[model samples]
Target: MNAEKPPGSKQALVIIGMHRSGTSATTGALRCLGVDLGNRLYKGHEGINDKGYFEHSDLADANDEALSALGSSWDDILLRQENWWKREELIPFAARIRSHIRKDFANSSIWAVKDPRVCRLLPWWLEIFDSERISPRFIFVIRSPHAVFRSLERRDGFSMEKSFLLWSLHYLEAEQWSRNFPRAFVDFDRFIEHPAQELARVEETLGISFPISVENAAPCLNQFLSRDLRHHQERESPESSPVLSLTHALHQSLLGAVDSGQPDSLEMDALWNKMESIQSGFPRALVEHIRSSGSIQGNLQITMNRLMRSWSWYTGKPVRFLERLAGRNV
Candidate 1:
C-alpha cells in the first residue's frame, strides 16, 4: 500500500473517543500505518497505561485548560454546553491551538491528534480547522461500556454507575458532533483481536495507505496490543444496568454502521434522545458550576499571588523605617 499523500491534499486524522476505550491503542496502530503522531507524545503512565499513550502532551494540556476555562473538567458529563465554542473567549486558545499544530506537525502531510478530551471539545477544534482551512478525518474508537467501566474502575477508582454515565455522555457527544466530518468508528474489542483487518478497514474508509507492509508493523503492534493489556474482559450476555444497556445498544449500533459503511442517523438520534430523556433529571447545572469552580480557584490563586507580591512591594519602605527605629533603640 502506498503511504504517500496524493498531490496537494492536506489532511489530518483526529482520534476522538472516550478515555480507556482503546484510543491509545488505535493511535499507536495508526502511527504504525504511517500516520505521524507529532514529536512530543505523552509517555504512558506506569500502573495505568504501561504502553505509551500516543497523545500530544501540549494538546492534552491545552484541552484541559480550555475545559477549565469553561468551568469543566475531563470527567465532566455536561460539558457540551450550547454555543460554548462560539464564545469570544475561545479565540486566544484557538490561536494557541493553531500554533501547536504548526509547531508539532510542521512538515507532515497527514498527522494525528488524540486526546479523549477532544471528544467534548470538538466544536472548538472544528472552529480552528475551519478558520485555518484544514480538513480533518476522524477515527472514533468504541468499546463495550462494561469493559470501559472496568478499566476506569481499575485506573481512576471510578464507580461503575458513574463510569457508565460518563461513557454514555462522551460517545453521545462524539457521535453528535462528528457526523458532519469524514469519520470511521472502530470497535476496540475487534481491533485488539484482529489488528490487520481493523487497520485495513480504517485505511479503506479514510482513503489512505500505510507507509510499510502490515508484516513490518506487526512487531511494533504486538508490543502494545497484547492480551495482558486487555485486562478487562467483557462478560458474555451478562446482566446490565439500565445505563449500561443503553450504552451497549449505542455501541452495537455504531459497530453495525461501521461494518456496513453506512451510519443510521435516525437510529442514532433515537438512541441519543432516549439517553437524554433518562438523564433529564441529573443535576447538570449544579455539576457544571462545581466543575467551573476549579477555574475560579485557579484564577483566584493567580490573583492572590499578585496581590501578595504588590503588598510586599508597597510595605517595604514602612518595614525598613520600623527596622531603623528598632536599631536606634537597640
Candidate 2:
C-alpha cells in the first residue's frame, strides 16, 4: 500500500453529485478521513439532514450566482454550453473562489470541497484550478433514482419525472465534464454499509491515502453514517418514460462503475446524447419558471397580492380618518 498524504499535499477533493444523492454524506465520510472541509459548512435541518450538510456554503452560494448569471439555476433541468461559465458575470465569483481557497486552506493540505452544484460547474472550477496551479480529484456520489425522487419529493415537492430528469442531467454532466480529470464514483448505499471498503476504493483511484484509516474513524462514521441518516431506502420502481429508463440505466451503470472503477461511458454515450437531444422539452416553460423561482408562481403571486393589500390599508388609514372627521364636522 502507498503512504498517506503528507502535510504539503495540495490535493483538492471535489465532491459532486445530484442533490439528495449522498454528496453530503460522502463529504462527511471524507472529513472523518482527515479531509479539511472548512468551517463554513451549511447547517443541517432537523428532519432533512440532521448530520450536517458538509457543504461549503461559500462555494455553494457562488455556484448559485454562477448559475443565475447564466439565467439558469440548480433546479433547472436545462444545461448551458460549456462557454457559459466563462462569461464576465462569472469572473468575480471565480476570483472569490480562488481567494477562498487561498485564505481558508492556507495551511491545510488534502482539503475537500463538496457541493452538488459542482457537478454542473466543473468547467468553471477547472479554469480556476489551472490558474491557481492546484490539482483536483473528483468523487461522484450515486444513489437510487427512486430513493432520490422520494427524498426530493419530501424536501422540495418535486415530481418523480422531474427528479429523474435532474438526476440524469447532474450525473451525466458530472461524468462528461470531469472525464479528463482523476475521478471516482461511490454508491451511497455501499458507502453507508461499508465505508472502509469505499474509502479504500477512493484511495486506489485518487492516489492519495487518507491520514486516518477507516478503522480509526469507525466511531465517527458509525455515528454520522447511521441507518437513520439515510431517510429513504432504495425501492425499485418502474420507469414510465424512455428518458426515465435511460436515467435508471445510468444509475445502475454508476453502481457498477463503483466496482469496475470505470463509468463505462461507451455504453452510456448514446443514452447521454439522446438525453441532451430531448432535454429542451423535458421541463416545459412553467416548470422552468418554478425551478428558477424555487417555488410555485401562483402561490407566490397570491402572497404578494396580500402584502400589497395590507400596505394599501395601512397607507390609507390617515386619509380615511381625515375624511371621517370632515364628514362629522359637516
How does model 2 fare in lDDT? 0.78
For candidate 2, the per-residue lDDT at 227 reads: 65
lDDT of 2 by residue, 134-231 (tens): 77888988889889999999999998888888999888877876777677888888888888888888988989878788789888877778666678
Taken over the whole model, the C-alpha lDDT of each candidate is 0.75, 0.78
TM-score of 1: 0.81
Best by TM-score: 2
lDDT of 1 by residue, 287-314 (tens): 6676677577545544543553465755
Clashing pairs in 2: none
Which pairs clash in model 1?
Answer: 71-292
How much is the lDDT of residue 127 in candidate 2?
A: 78
How many angstroms is residue 182 displaced in model 1 relative to the true structure, after the best TM-score fit?
A: 2.0
Candidate 1: list runs displaced more than 4 Å: 1-8, 236-242, 283-289, 292-330
Alpha carbon lDDT of residue 71, candidate 1? 70
lDDT of 1: 0.75
Error of 1 at 214 (Å): 3.0
